[model samples]
Target: MSKEDPKTNSGYERTLTNAHIQLIALGGTIGTGLFLGVGNSIHQAGPSVILIYIIVGIFLYFLMRALGELVLSDLHKHTYIEFIEKYLGKNIGFITGYLYWISWISLGMAEMTALGIYFQYWFPHLPTWVPGLITIVILLFINLLSARLFGNLEFSFAIIKIVTIIAFVFLIAYLLVTGGKTSFGPVGFGNLAKNGGFFATGANGFLGGFQMVIFSFVGVELIGLTAAEAQNPKVTIRKAINELPLRIILFYVMAILAILLVIPWNKIATTSSPFVQALGATGIRNAGSIINFVVISAAVSSTNSFLYSAGRLIFSVTYDGKGKWNETFGHLHRQLPQNGLILSACLMGLAPLVIILIGNQAFNFISSTSTSMFLIIWCLMILTHLSYRKQTPANKLTDFQMPQYPWLDYLTLAFFGLMIILLLSLPANRMAMISAILIFIILWAVSKIWHQERAI
Candidate 1:
C-alpha cells in the first residue's frame, strides 16, 4: 500500500506479501546450520539434539512474537533499529544495528565457506576458494537487484530446501517400511537409542550441543527485517510469526527424527553431512552426491539472504539522522541500497579469502563469533520488547500482542541468559563470547566520546 521509506524521502515500495515473508523466513532459518552443522551436533549430543531444537525453537517463538507485536504496534516504522533509537538511546540503537550488520556479514562468510567445502566433496582437487569466491560473486549480483528479486530468490531456495527434507524423510520412511538393510544394518526407529541412551553424551555433552543448536536458528529473526518491505506489516508479519512453531517442527524436529530412524546416532558421521551419509548407507544410488547438491543450494540461498539483509540493515541504521555515516550511506538508489550492498559484498567477499588463506580453522573461529554475536542480538530484541512494554501504557493500542506479556518476556530473557552461560562452558564458544563483549564495550565507549564532542 505504501511505497516510501518511513524515515527517508526515498520511495522504497512495500512489495513483499505474506508468502514472500514466510518463505524468506523459512530459507533463512533452514540453512547450512541444519544441513552441515547438525551432523556435528548429533555427534556431540546423540538423539537428545531433538530436545535442544525444541527448546531453542520455543524460546525463539516467544521472541519473534514479541518482535511482531512491536512492529505491528506502529505500522509506519520499517525496522526495530529505529525503535531502539526511539525507545532506548541513539547509542544503543547505533551499536545494535552495526553489530547485527557485522553478524550477518560473518554469517555470509560461513555459508560461503561451507559452499566451498561442499563442492570439494566432489572434486577433491578443487581449491576451497574457488567455490566461495564464485558464490559470493553470484549472490552479490542477485542481491543488487530489487527487494522483490531478493524475496523471489529466497522463496525459490525455500522450495528447494522443503523438497529435499521431505524427500529425505519419505525415503527413510519407505526404507523402514520395506525392511531395507545396508552396510550399517536394518533401518528402524530403535537407532535413536540403540547406540546409547537419549542423553548418551552426558549432561555436559547435551549442554554443549546448545551452542550449535542455537546457531542453527541464527536467521530465525530475519522475518523482523522483512516487515519494512511487507505489503501489510500487521497481517503479513502476524501470519508469518504465528506459523513459526509448525515450521520449526516440520523443518528441524521431524527431519532429524527421520535421519535418526534410518541410522544409529553413533553411526552418523560427524564430519560429513548426516543426511547424505544416512541415505547413502541405505543403498540409495548417488545419495551423497544428490544431497551435496541440495546442500550447495542451501548454502547459496543463505549467503544471498544474509548479504541482502546486511546491506539493508546498514542503510536502515545510517539513514536515520543521528547515524555517523548518514551523509553518504543514508539513502537508496533505484529503490535499493546500492552503495551499502556493494560495501557489504566487498567485506563479505573478504571472509572467503580469509578462509582460503588461513584454512578451515579460520572459518570455524569466525563462525563461532558470528553465532555468539547473533545470540547477543536476540537478547537485545527481547530487551527492546521489555523496554517497549515498560514505556508504553497498558492502554496503548497494538494490532498484535505477544500473549502472556511480562512473564513470557521474562522467561525469554532467562532462556537467553542460560544459553550464554552454556556458551561460556564450552571452549569452542568462549573466545567468541569474549570477542562479542569486547566489541560492545568498544562501541559504547566510542559512541559516548562522539556524543560528548557533538554536545560540546
Candidate 2:
C-alpha cells in the first residue's frame, strides 16, 4: 500500500496482517481480570455468569460488525472518530473523539498500576512505582521506534496470552480424564448445574455480572483502529470482524467454564487469581508460579494495547481540531505517533506515583472513575453507530452491514442504558457515574470556548 502524508496524520505504513489484527483483538479483550476476576461475577451470579458473557458477546459482535462496515466503506478512515464526524454532526464527533482519547489514557494508567501490583508479587522489596516507570519506558520505546515493531511486540504479547489459555484448557481436560478426588468421576460436566444449581444467584445476579462482563469487552472495537495500519485493509478487516464472535465465545465462555468447573463457584476467591486456584485444585505443584507469569503478561499486553490506541485517538482528535494540544503531538516517527505515545506513557507512569502520594483509597477511586469513563465511551460508540447507519445510503451499505440492523442496534443501546441504570443504583459505582458526567460537561464547555474563539 502507498503511504499517505505524515504531516496531516493521514497516512502510516500498513504493516499489520490478518493474524496480527486477530491477536490484537484477542489481547485487548482477554485480560488479567477475566483470568483472575470472574470469580466475583460467579459469586454474584453463580453459573449463570456464563449466560451473561453469551448475551453481551452477541450484542458486542453486532456492534463491532457495524463498526467494521463503516471502516470497510472507506479504507482511509481508520479511526471511528473520523466516521462519526463524516456521518454525525461535528460537535458529537468532537465530543466522542476526545472522550474516547481521555478514557483510554485513564485506562492505560490503570493497567500500568495493575502491572505494578503484579510486579510486587515477584519483587516485594522493590518499590511498586519502580516497575510501573520501567514498564512505561519500555512500551514508549517500542511504540516510538516503529509501528511494525509495536505490532510485533503486541503480536508476541498476544501469543503468550493465547498459548497460556490453550495450555490451561488442555490441563483442564486432562484433569477431567484422570479422575480426581471428587465423586463426579473422570469427566464431569455437572459443575454447570450442580453447585448453587446454575443461576444460584438468580436474575439479579445475572444483572450484576453485566457490569464487569461488559468491561471485559472494552477494547474489542480497537480492531477498527488498525485498519489504516493493516497491510490490506479490506481483507484484514473482514477476517478479523468475522471471527470476533467465535473468539469471544471460545476464549471467554470456555475459559470461564473451565475455571468454574475446576473450582466450585462458592469456593473460588475473587481476591486471588482464579487460574492459580484452578490449577492448584488440579494438583499442579507449580501452578502459582505459572499463573503469575501469565497474569503478568496479561497486564503488560493490556497496557500496551491501551497505550497504542490512546496515542492514535489523541493524534486523530488533534488533527481534526477537536482538542488543544501541540501540533507536534500528531507527528509520526517510523509510521507511529511517537510524541503521543511518549506523552501517554509518561502520564501512565505518573498515575502510580500520584496514587502512592495520595493513598490506596485514592488509587481505587481513580480506577473506578476510569471504568465509568469507559462505559460512557462505549455507549457513545453504539449511539454514533446508530446515527451513522441512519445517514448512510442503503445502497452503499453493502460492504459489511450489521446483521439484523435496527433491532440489534436498538437492543444494544438498551443494554448499555440498563448498565448505566445499574451503575446509578449501586453505591460503589455512584461516584464513577457522577465523575464521568462531570468530565463530559467540562469537555463540552471547553469545546464551546474553542469554537467561540475560532469564530472571532
Candidate 3:
C-alpha cells in the first residue's frame, strides 16, 4: 500500500472513463439476481413473471432519475448518502451510510456464493464454496491495483454479458419463428399461453415472486455509486441514467421473454440458471456450456462491482469522522481506499463459510437480505431527493431533474413500500426482512452512542 493520506478523506480520482461508467451501469444490473434468481421467479409466477420484472424495473428507473438529479445537483459529493446527510440530516446519514455499506458487503457475499453454483454446471462434483473463495482473492488483488483496472475489468465483463444476452434473444427469436423443437418440445408462443394460461400459478404466486423479482433489479442504481470515480460525471451519469429504459427492455424483458418462449416457464429450473436450461434443451452442441460460462462471468463481474461499491462506501462514511473506527477505515493509500478494500473483501471472503453453513439456501437468503436493506436505503434516497427539491428552488435545480417532481418520488416510494410489505408477509422472505429491520435499529442505536461520545 502507498503512504496513507489522512489530510483528505478519500484518494479516489476521476480515472473511470465514460465507457467504463456506461458498461458498469449495464453490468451492474445484469448480475446474479437476473442470471440465477430469475429461475425462482419463473418457478413462482410462470410467464406472468414478465410483468413483475417490468413493474419493478419501472419503479427503480424512477429511483435512478431521482438519484441522478441529486448527484447532478452537487458533483463534489462522494456517494448517495452525502445527499441523505444534506437533506435528511446527519444522524440519518450516519445510519444510512453504514447500512448501505453493509448492504453492498452482503451483496458481494451473495454474488460470490453464486459463483459456486454457476461453476457446478462445468464441474458438478466441485465443492460449492471453492470457486467463490478463489475468486474473492484474485479480484481483491486486481481491485487493489487501481480504480482504472477495476473499471477495465467491469467493462470487459459487462461486454461479455451484454453480447451473450443479445445473441440469446436473437437466436431464440429465430427459433420461435421457425417452430423449432427442443427437448422440452416445440418452441412457440403457445408454450406461454397454454401452461396454465400465462398466469400459471395465479395471483398468490405472482405476488410471492415479487421479492425475488425485486432482488433481480438490485444493482440498477450502481451508476450513482460510480459518480465519485467517474470522469465527466455530468455527461456520463446523465447518459447512463437516461438509457435505463432500453437496458431494461433488452437485458431483463427481452432476455426472459426469449427464455420462456423456448422452455415452458413451469419447466424452468430453480436450482440452476434458466438461461442455461433453455439453451441446453436445444441440444445445440456447447450452447448450454457457453451460457454457463457467461453466467459465471456475470457472477464474477457482479462480485467485483459489489466489492468496489462496499470499499468506497466505507471510505465515504468514515472519512473525516472522529473515533478509532473512522481512523481505521476512512483513509486512503496509493489514492485508493486500500484498507477499505481489504476489509470489505475479507468480510466477503467469509461468504464461503456461510455457504457451508446454509448449504443450498445461502445465496437466496443473502440476496433477499440485501434486497431488504436496499429497499430501506432506496426509500431514504428518494426522501433525500424530495427534500432536495423542496429546499432548492426551480431556478436552482439541475437540468437533469426528475420530471414531475414530488409526485414521481411518492409513486416510486409507494411501489417500494408495497414490495417491502410483500417481503415481510411472505413466509420465505420474512426472516431476512426481520433481520434487516433489526440491523437498522441496531445501527440507529450505535449512531446514537457515537453522538453521545462526541458530545463529551
Candidate 4:
C-alpha cells in the first residue's frame, strides 16, 4: 500500500488460499484451448486426439512435478524466472523472463480475440473488436484490485467451467447408454471410430495435433506461479501438481470424447467451440447459447489469468534493475504491479486490431505464436530444474523431489524438443518457430551490450 517504489520485489501478499490455488490450477487448463482450439485439434487428429492429450498430459505432469519441487525449494522467489537466474545464469534468465512475459501477453491476446467470436453467438452484428477491447478494459480493472479479488473471481469462473464440463460429459454418457436421440440422431461411442477409425487422420494428422495439444497445456504452469501468492505454497502446489494428470484426463480427455461421440471428428467445427456445436446439435433450444456463455467465460477467465501473469512476470524480470524499462515496470503501486498490469492490458487490448489485420486466422496465429515462445521457456525451466537437482547437496535437498530424477527431466526436454521440431517442420508454423529463436538471441545480445555500456 506504500506510495513509493520498494527497494526490492521480495514480498508479495500470500492471499491466495488452498481453494483459490486449486481452482486456478483447474481453471488454467480448461480455457480457449480446450473450448475453441479443441475443435481444431479434433479436426486434425481425429479420435486419436484422445491419445494426444494423454501423452502430452503425462509429460507435462512430470514438468509440473519438477516445477513444484523447484518452487517449494525457495518460496522467497516470486517466480521460476528467479530460480532460472540463480541456476542458469542471468543472461538466460533475462531472455527467458521477457519471452515468458511476451508469451503470456500473446495468450491474453488470443483469449481476447476469441471473446469477440464468442460474443457474436448472441450479438451477430457486434464488431469483433468491440467485445475484445471491452473485455480487456473490464478484466484489467478487476486484476488491478487485489490478488485476493483476482483469486476469488477466478474461483467463480473456474467453478462455472468445471460444472458445465462435468455435466456435459455426464449428459453425453447418459445419452449413449439409454439410446437417447439428438437432432443428429442417437449419440453413440462409435463416433470415435466411425469416421475412419481412431488414427483416421493418419500419422501426419496425429503429429499435427501435437501443436494445439501443447497449446492447451500452456497454462499448466499457473500453479507454480501462484505458489508465491499462496498461503501454503508447499501443500497447495503439491496437491495441484499431483492431481494434474487426473484433471487433464477428465477435463480434456473426457470432454473431447463427449463432444466427438455426439459429432464425429471429421464433422467437428473448427472456428467456434465443438462443445457448443455438440450441444446445438442436441435439438435442445438454447443449448448452444448456454454453452457459448460458458465458453466465453472460459476465455475471459484465461485472459484474466494471463494478464495477471504477464504483469507479475514483467515485474519479476525487471525488478531491482536499472534503466527506463526497469524503472517503468519494476515497481509496485499500492502493493500491486500497477505499471506491469497496465502495460500488459494495453497490449492485449490491441488484440482486436491484430484480428482485423489477420482476418479469421488471428486466434490460431496468436496462439501458435504464444506456444512457440512457451516451448523455449519450458525448455529453460526444465533445464533450470535439472540444474537445481545437480547442484543441491543431498543433505540440503527437500523431501519433495521430482520423481524419476534426471531421466524424467531429460525425457520432458525431449518431448518439448520434438514439439519444436514438429513446429519448425510445418510451413504454417515455421515462421513463428524461427522468430522465437531469433528473439532469444536478440535479447541475449541486447543484454550483453547494455551491460558493457554500464561497465564502461
Candidate 5:
C-alpha cells in the first residue's frame, strides 16, 4: 500500500456506520462495572448512588465534548496521541501515548480475568484460564482480519447489552407493580427513602461512591479513538458525545433506581452482581443465569474495545516515530492494522496464564494499578486540552474551541486531581498510585532521551 493510497494512507476503514459507533460506545462504557460493581457503590452511597452517577455523567459529558471539538478542528487521520503531540509537544505526546497503551493493555487483562470468573458459573469444571485464553484468541482474530468485522462483532455485543439493560429496567418495574413474595406491596418511589431515606449513608457515602461511579464511565471517550475509522467522523463524533448524558441517565441512573426500588439498598450484596441478586430477590430463579450471560457479553465487549484501543494507541505511537512503524503492523489489510491487532490479542491471551501463575491476589493488584493509571491519563488529557487552548491563538479558536474555554478545562482538571488525592489517601489504592507515578516518571525520562537523540 502506497503512502499516497487513499485507502491505506487513511489508516483505517471508514466502514463503521453511525449505529456501529454508537453501539460500540455503549458497549464500551456500560460494562461489568454497572452490572457487578454497582452493589458496592450502592453500599457506599445508598440511594445517593443515583446522584453520584449523574455527577460523573456531567463531567464525562464535558470531557467528550472537549474531545469531539479537538478531533473535528484537526481533521487529520490522527489518534488521541496525535492530538497530544500536536498540542502538548512531541515528548508529552509520546509519553501519553505509551501510558494509554499500557493502561488499555492492563484493562484488557482485567476484563479477561472477569470473563473467566463469569464463565465459571456454568462451567465449573473448566479452568478459568481456558475461557480467558479462548476469548483473547477469538477477539484477536476478528480484530486482525478486518476492522469491519470487529465493528460488526462489537455492534452485536452492544445490542445485546443495551437490550438486556432495557429489559431489566422493564422487568424491575413490572415486579415492583405486581408485588413480590414478601408483602412489599407495590414497591414504589417510597423505596428511595423508606429504608433510611435519601442519603441514607450520608455525605461520606456519596463521596466514597464517586470513585466507582467514575470507573463506570472509564471507556466513554472511546468514540473519540474511533473517529479516524468512522464512516462519517464529524457527524458520528458529535452525536455520540452529545448523547452521552442521556445514555448515562438511562443506563446507569434509571437502572440503579430500579434495582434499589425493587430490592432494598441495605439488602444488596457487595460481592455478587447486584443485577442478579436484585432479580433473585424478586423470586426470579433463573436471574443468576440471565445476568451471567449479560455480564459475559459485557466483558467480551470491554475486551474487544480495549483490544481495538490498544492496537490504535500503539500504531499511533509508531506513526509519530516513537516506535518502529512495522510495515506489517501499521499496514492496513482489509482496513485493519493487522499486526497491531495480533500483538494485542497475544498479550491479552497471555495475561491470564501469567495472572494464574502469580495468584488471584496479584491479578487484583495489577487491575487496580491499571485503573489508577487510567485516572492519570484522564488528567493528562484534560490538562493537554487546557494547554492547547492557551497556546492556540485567539483567532484560531473558532474552529474547535472548548466550551467555557479554560474554566471548564480547569474544573475538570481539579476534579481529576481530587480523585488522585483520594486514591493516594486510600491505603488499598496507594500501591497502585505509586506504581502509576513510577511509570509516568520512567516515560518522562524516556521522552527526554528520545528528544535528545532526535536532536543530534
Candidate 6:
C-alpha cells in the first residue's frame, strides 16, 4: 500500500484520490437523511423546509472551510482529533474523540435501520432484521478488504444517488413544461404554494422541521477524515471542500425542490420517501419499484461511509496513544485497522437488529440522537479552529485559509449554539438533546478519572 502524506508514520496507507474523497464526502451527506428523512421534514415544515436546508448548508460550508484551513496547517495530522489534542487539551481531545465515534456509530445504526425499511418494500412479509443482518456482514467483509475498496464502493454509491437526483430533476422539468398530470396532481412550481401557502405548517412547523433537516447534513464534514488517506492531502481536500456548495445545491436543494414541484407538500406521505412519492405520482409504470431500488442503494451507501468513518476514528485515537487500548486497538493488519474495523462493525451492527425489534419508534430515536451528537462535534471543530487561528504567528502563512476568519467563525458558532437550544423546543428532539448533554458529562468524567489513573 502507498502512503499519501509522509509527515507522520502510521500503519495505514494512503491509496485514495480526489475522486474518492469527493464521492465519499458526498455519499456520507446525501444518503439516508435525504432519501428517508426528507419525507418527515416535508411533513412537518411544508415547503419552508427548503429554507431550513439553505440555512444549514451555509453554516456547514463555514464549518468545512474552517476544517479545511486547520487540516492544511498541518498535513502531519491524519485526524482532526490530533489537532484538537494539540489546541484544546488532552481531556477535550479524549472527549471529542469518543463523542465523534459515538456520533458515527449512531449514524451507521440509523442507516442500517433504514436499509431494513427499504428492503421491506420488496419483501413486505420478510423480517427487517434479516436484511439488516445480511447487510452488516457484507459491509464488514468489504471494509476489511482494503481502504481503496471502501472508497470504490462509496464512489459507486454516490454516483447512483447523484444520477437518481439528476434524473428526477430533468423528469420533473419535462413534466412541468409539458403540463403533465399525475395521479397526485399537475406538475409545476404552483404545487409549492397551492397546498396552504409555502409556510403551510406555520412558524412552529418550520422551526420543528430543523431537527430532521439538521440530520441530513450530519456527515458532510467527514471530508476531514480523508486527509490522512488522500493522495495529496492539501490539494485533494481543498478541491473536495470547494466543490461542496454545488453538491449541496444540486443533490439536496434542487432534488427537494423538484419533488415538491411534482407533488404538493400536504399530499406527501410521511412514511415513504418524498422522491418515491413524487416519482410514483407521475403515473409512470413501475416507477415505485425503480425509486425503491434507488433508495436501497442510498441506504447501503450511507452504511458503507458510516462503517469506514467509525473505524478510522477509533484507530486514529488509539494509534496516537490517547486511549488505554493503544497497542491492541491500534494494531493494523495489512495496513488496515482490522481490530478497530471489526469492533466498530460488531457494535454498530447490533443497533439495526435492536431497532427492528423495537419497531418504528427506534428510527426517530436514533436519528435524533445522532443529530444532536453531530451538532456538538461540529461546534467542537469550530472552537478548535478558532484556537488554532488565535495561536498562529502574525507572519505565518497557511496554504488554505478559512475566508473571513474571525467573524465568520464566531457567527457559525453562534448559529450552532442556537440550533442546540432550538432542538430542545421540539418534543421529538428534546430527549436526544438531553441525552447528548448527559453523554458529554459522562465522557468528561471518565476522561478525567482515566487521566488521573494514568498519571499515578
Q: Pick the candidate with the highest lDDT.
A: 3
lDDT score at residue 44, model 3, on the 0-100 scale: 91
The reply for model 1, stretches above 4 Å from the true place, is 1-10, 322-324, 356-358
Question: What is each predicted model's overall lDDT from 0 to 1?
Answer: 0.82, 0.74, 0.89, 0.89, 0.77, 0.85
Query: Taking the tens digit of each residue's C-alpha lDDT, what string does model 2 give over 320-430?
Result: 343347477755666677778877777777776666875534334455566677677667777777877787778877567888877887888787777778877767668
**Per-residue lDDT of model 6, residues 1-456, tens digit only:** 124343246756778877998888777778888998999999999999999999899999999999999888877676899899999988999899999988888888888788778887788887666666688789989999998998999899889988888999999889989998888778888878787889999999999899898999988888888877778777778888888888889888999999998888888876667787888889889898899899988888888888888898888778747455888777678888888889888887787566757787777789999999888888899999999999998568486888888999999999999989998878888999999988999999999998998899
In order of TM-score, best first, we have: 3, 4, 6, 1, 2, 5
Q: lDDT tens digits, residues 72-100, model 1?
A: 77765656777787777889988888888
Candidate 4: worst 10 consecutive residues by lDDT?
1-10
How do the candidates rank by lDDT, highest first?
Answer: 3, 4, 6, 1, 5, 2
Inter-residue clash pairs, candidate 2: none
Model 4, range 232-318, lDDT digits (tens) per residue? 777888888889989998999999989988997888878788999999988878999999999999999999999999999999999
Off by over 4 Å in 4: 1-9
Give per-model TM-scores.
0.95, 0.91, 0.97, 0.97, 0.91, 0.96
Which 10 successive residues of model 2 have the least lDDT summed? Answer: 1-10
> Which scores higher on lDDT, 4 or 6?
4
Q: Model 3 — which ten-residue stretch has the worst lDDT?
A: 1-10
> At residue 443, what lDDT does model 1 achieve?
80
**Residue 121 error, candidate 3, Å:** 1.3
The collision pairs in model 6 are none
Cα lDDT for residue 289, model 3?
A: 92
Residue pairs with clashing backbones, model 3: none
lDDT of 5 at 382: 86
Error of 6 at 305 (Å): 0.7
Candidate 3 — what's its lDDT?
Answer: 0.89
Off by over 4 Å in 6: 1-8, 322-324
* Per-residue lDDT value at 367 in model 1: 70
